[model samples]
Target chain A: MSRFLSVLLHGFWKDLPPFRLVLGLCPALAVTASANNGLGMGMSVTFVLIFSNLVISLLRNVIPNKVRIASYIVIIATLVVIVEMILQAYFFGLSQQLGIYIPLIVVNCIILGRAEAFASRNTPFLSAVDGLSIGLGFTMSLTVVGSIREMLGAGTWFGMSLASAEFEPFAFMIKAPGAFICLGLLLGLMNAFSHWRGENVIQK
Target chain B: MDLVLLAISAIFVNNILLAQYLGNCPFCGVSKKLSTSLGMGAAVIFVATLASIFTWLVYYYLLEPLGLKYMQTLVFILIIASLVQFVEIFLKKFSKPLYNALGIYLPLITTNCAVMGIALLNIKHEFGFWEMVVFSISSAAGFTLAIILFASIRERLFISHVPSFMKGTAIALVTAGIMSLSFMGFSGMVN
Candidate 1:
């Protein structure tokens, strides 16, 4: 029971994608200017991750080992295209908002990394759980960073005006430099927090 | 005149790493040392130029005609991977000196988002043949320019006493943020 739970929840802090593992950072920085954008991008990734992991796990034995990377890339890319098409069909606004980053997810190390590392070795059910947990972890971190950035950069939270009118926002918080600095500080704070508790934090 | 403006824009206004957030993993990973960064940049310049052109051709002539445009992301990635593998083997067999310099970084380019991103952008912008050619090469040149500059900045950062907690990636990312701010100065060059 504990082991099952661990595999599911491990990605929250132990293997947080951007903060600890540092995988899937392109979207972490690119679409995180707003909480809404962060949530949208994270959810898209989660959908791709979960489905790809399941398919990979199911076909683990049948597919040859030598060409598995290529196979995984194809599966992931196809799934991403499906996601993009769906978004374009149903969620036209978000499809436009994410733009290239949607397709770029095909190269995000996290999806391929997990497909290679965890899913290839585990059962379909277990792999699905892992994917869910990790995707949720990614979603949480992105949302937190986005909220902070949006709050500071535009005086809003998830597109809602939080600050009173006439308040000059810290516009820098949404720029490229701001994204880097915010994530850096967040990473440092995570390390500090874990260190104070004597928890081992692996920086990948 | 258009080509010149495109070159300036890709290098500065739309600088691949700082602006689009592509190729960041390698940007941070291989950027610690100046020499290695230079090597990575050169490797990227070569592969990116070639791969972008190749993908552009494939996308337009093949995919457009067959109505397989939806499969572009998959096809482009496979092409980039095979191209890198082909280059690795060809270089190893032919030019020992050039191969030795770029051998290790060839495989890494397969995953660099800049290569993929540029190919896609060229299509999205609906660029013509010469326009695509100029854009791909110059965008890659822009990536090379940003990486080398980042490498130098990181070299100087080694001397300073960074805090214990903010030792590696934390500090590196913060420094990149500062560099990003500086690059913002060029946003108006193209427009």
Candidate 2:
């Protein structure tokens, strides 16, 4: 039980997908223009990650060692297609917002990284927990980054205007460059905080 | 003229790395040194173009006729993985020096989103064979250009006084942001 618990919590902070592990950054940067988009993208990734981890863990024994990577890609791609269809059916606006990123999730690295590292070696139940934890961690990071960008850029939080009408949005905060700079500075700040607390920062 | 504009736009305005955010792992991971970045760039130029061509062919000749368009993500990835394997073996047999140059980077290209992203974009934009060829080469060229410039900047950063916490990827990412900002200036040149 403790092992499961530890596995679950690690992804939250210790191995936070985008910040700590530094995996799945392409989606982290691309679809985070608005808080809604971030949440949508994060949820989609979470769904895919959970199922892919579960399936990969279950098949770990059966899949040939030589072709495990290819098998994993096939599984991840199928899950992404399912998610893409669901989003198109129910969340058309967001699907449009995310654009190619939805399909690009196949190469996000986080899914593949987890499948290769944790899932392949762990029990199915434990792997599922790992998936949930890591997926949520990724979701949390995207949401935080998205909230920051959306609030600063559009003076809104999840589409709710938080800033006064007089506030002029810093339009640059929502652009391509802003994604890099914002995530960079946030990462640096996290490192500084980790250092002050005497925890060894995960150097990516 | 339109083809030239497409090339410029793909290379500059829609840079696969800076603007589109594809293939960022190598953008950050393999960009620390000039020599390795050059090698990776060349490998990408070679493989991405080939992958694009083959994927385009497979899409038009096989998937579209069979109405397997939904399988694009899966098919494209499998094609790229196998294609990378074939290229690796082909290079090892034919050109020892070329293989030596791109040996390490070839395997990594299978997972690089830029290769897959370019394949998907070629289809999305509905480019014909000639247009796909132009777009693929220029897009890879754009990737090469960005990484080379980034490597030069990162080399300089090694000597600069970066704060301790921001020493590695953090600082590199911040620099990439500035570079991306500069690249945004080209957006006006197209569209």
List the lowest-lDDT window of 10 residues for candidate 2 chain B.
B167-176
Model 2, runs deviating above 4 Å: A202-204
Question: If you score just chain A, what TM-score does every candidate get?
Answer: 0.97, 0.98
Deviation (Å) of B152 in candidate 2: 0.7
TM-score on alpha carbons, each prediction: 0.97, 0.98
Lowest-sum lDDT 10-residue window in model 2 chain A: A195-204
Q: Give the candidate number with the greatest DockQ.
A: 2
Q: Residue by residue across B18-78, what tens digits does model 1's lDDT show?
A: 8888898888889988889888988988998888889989998999999999898889988
What is the two-chain DockQ of model 1?
0.72
Which pairs clash in model 1? none
Q: lDDT by residue for model 1 over A57-92, one digit each (tens)?
A: 999999999989889988999999999899989999
Shift of residue B33 alpha carbon in model 2, Å: 0.3
Score candidate 2 by TM-score against the native.
Answer: 0.98
Query: What DockQ does each candidate score versus the true complex, computed on alpha carbons?
Result: 0.72, 0.78
Looking at model 2, the pairs that clash are: none
